[model samples]
Target: MPSVAEGVKLGIQECQHQFRGRRWNCTTIDDSLAIFGPVLDKGRKLRNWTKRRQAREQGSTPPAATRESAFVHAIASAGVAFAVTRSCAEGTSTICGCDSHHKGPPGEGWKWGGCSEDADFGVLVSREFADARENRPDARSAMNKHNNEAGRTTILDHMHLKCKCHGLSGSCEVKTCWWAQPDFRAIGDFLKDKYDSASEMVVEKHRESRGWVETLRAKYALFKPPTERDLVYYENSPNFCEPNPETGSFGTRDRTCNVTSHGIDGCDLLCCGRGHNTRTEKRKEKCHCIFHWCCYVSCQECIRIYDVHTCK
Candidate 1:
């Protein structure tokens, strides 16, 4: 198994890559970790409060699980799984090897050979390490677990089959096939879609044979129950236009934006209606190219200027 640090680094990289153009682009991983420490501490306090049977005395509102949190958790877990599985297949980790438990024999035209990447092992290890961070067995923990599983499931559901063909003069006589993980971008896109449709959930307590168990349910009656694959949250997020130390929001001031974009990355939207500053930048690049008789190609340098927009 790869080290925990390796998995975390990969997760952070994926998060940043996926949200690069968004307002809350996950630029505060260190702050997030620091905030998580306080979250765990509060979880312990809440657990004690519940045990004392004095929940009515506090009258404090429950912590709100925002969509941002859900996205972060999902992407982080998926990133760890992806990194670990790829590392195993590449022989970078000593704990495991390529997946050899594929079913069925070679078909008429194709053979199922070569080491298949082991995603199951990756999922198992990710769950063990990532889920361990949630020490309290509460609704928040359950929510985190669900999102983590959903992330792993996204990766597994998107695995693609790649094949190499072998034949005489491209006759395609035989083929070797293996299951490969999809591009990280695909996973990011899928998660982003889920984030758009994320549901608001409320944690409720129910008495069971074992004990009083907390479970997450949709906060709105009209909203359907969230499936294992859906992302769920409990709280609304800050506007993120200005820095909020309590919520760890760094704000969008001075960030680059697309001048012509009509989406979230647009100057108007990204700057939160504060407007933006624009400047022209000149860039040099290879333009005209000619192929030589042998194989060498040559290109001429060209200069181009474009406007760059930044949030105020």
Candidate 2:
């Protein structure tokens, strides 16, 4: 008979380890495993109980490690982490007791976000969670169905930025290029120049600042747009068009719209199966609005929003 330690490893190896969907949860042969395939595929070893049993039957259980072999414990500990991520192990799960495991801060992580695991792991786990939800054939967002809640990080923060939320200026801590280019044109002149919503904002702000006299500068100085105001301003600009609300028809000008978690057959092929125009909104705004608009955004596709154009 294998020891408790061996059983722990075996449990960790189970890929359907703790499989579950919005309404279906399975990690065993007797449970529905079809829907959990992708999750299993992502970390098969961590969720393959049958393989663990086969190995146990073959008398392949390795000898227990001493304190000197603590590295082995790291794998075992991380295996538990993976299981928790898969929504198995009931109650609460946290890594414990790894002396040589420098993967993350070595300590008890009973509380979420208390232990700082590498950002990459957080990103990967969040992605798997997102995928597990998106492909689940359910209309519910992951926010409504996912079991793990603390595994996500902003893309910028995921890159190891010390901070990503409100900065010293009490703003989004994120922005773009500077205004005072060596060319140094007037702000209003620059605003009237061509109006690149992205770059021209900087030019406009610069003009507003310099337009005042130094004596009254402190009182009548720059009229910078607040976060709320800027948000409304860019509601149409690229700077503000992220995840641009998939409402109504893909055509910005079209009145009728249809946004649903429908089948992915067309999205995967960029064919939309209906001759829709997948051109960027920026590109569309530049046009004379003479064509019939039919656009769809396969978020997984290009980084920009596009308008689907049809040939007359």
Candidate 3:
């Protein structure tokens, strides 16, 4: 339970860090488990009024499964697996601990020793718990499950061998190696890359052994089929330039932007062509300090001015 809590916290922090400059910014409503409020709803109704009208005439499409939702599911699931694996390695779990049986053959003068974090066990726990709620017979459920697996798979893919030298004085006489998880930031980076290139999918309804079922397929046939490690979504994302509760876009209003950057965080792009305002401010800081014989030090105050840019 402690590991689960730690994992959720880790996931949320990494999510916020990864999306700090983006429009959505992974805003959480409150402290409860529903951190992502209505943002997680069936995505904002297709922004265009024409599309909405057409959809309404065409029997109206189901709420969309947005890429943002895909990312949230993946990161949250990965966080849980990572935390649970760390707990196992640290002997904090009663049912699971170091994966002694999953090591590879011994190498030159070194054997797989020490507690290898049981990432597999952690993934199993995540699947059993995180995936249980996604059992609905819908394409969105399938997408969510896929993203969840992708997140856990990232943990497995990033596992590396760590070694410790056992010698009299730091000599490499013998070594103990074990598998370890990569830094959570690295995992977040990988997932973010996946999110950027996430495949857009369309629902495909067909007959199955049980009955007619809904599945997802790439919207474009020429595009490569998405693998289990890839993130997939069935709807186009909102521009997120303005506050719209429907699409969960917090909007870039007043959000800090980079004046010089030409990327997404830059004022030009982030402000959605609305332009930005710049302001200069001064702040006092320690300029110089001298250490005394008694270890006491003093510094002069210096004021520095810098320009700040925010979306208008």
Please report the candidate that would top TM-score against the real structure: 3
Model 1 misplaced regions, further than 4 Å: 1-4, 29-64, 206-213, 297-303
What number of clashing residue pairs does each candidate have, in the order they appear? 0, 16, 1
Question: TM per model?
Answer: 0.82, 0.16, 0.85
Candidate 1 lDDT, 1-312, residue by residue in tens = 344456656666676776777777766423233322343222233333333222221111112367877877787788888888888898988889888877567678998866788888888887887777675557877777888888888888888777889999987789888888888888888998998999888889988877888888899888788888889987677777775444545567778899889998899898899999999999998989999999899999999998888888
Provide the overall lDDT of each model, using Cα atoms, as 2-decimal numbers: 0.73, 0.24, 0.80
Q: Model 3: C-alpha RMSD to truth?
A: 6.7
Instruction: Kindly provide the TM-score of model 1 when superposed on the true structure, using C-alpha atoms.
Output: 0.82
Q: After superposition, how far is residue 158 of candidate 3 from its true place, in Å?
A: 0.8
Q: Which clashing pairs does model 1 show?
A: none
Model 1, residue 160: displacement in angstroms? 3.0
Tell how far residue 235 is off in model 2, in angstroms.
Answer: 39
- The sequence of per-residue lDDT tens digits that candidate 2 reaches over residues 1-312 is 122233224333321122111001112222222221222221123334445333321111111111101111222222323333322122232432111222343223111122223323423443443344433222122211221122121121222212223346666544221111111112112222212221111112222344622110111126543221011111121111111112101111211122222332222222233333334454323322333345533222223465444211
User: For model 1, where is the 10-residue window of minimal lDDT?
Assistant: 53-62
Query: Model 2 off-target regions past 4 Å?
Result: 1-27, 30-35, 38-120, 129-145, 148-312
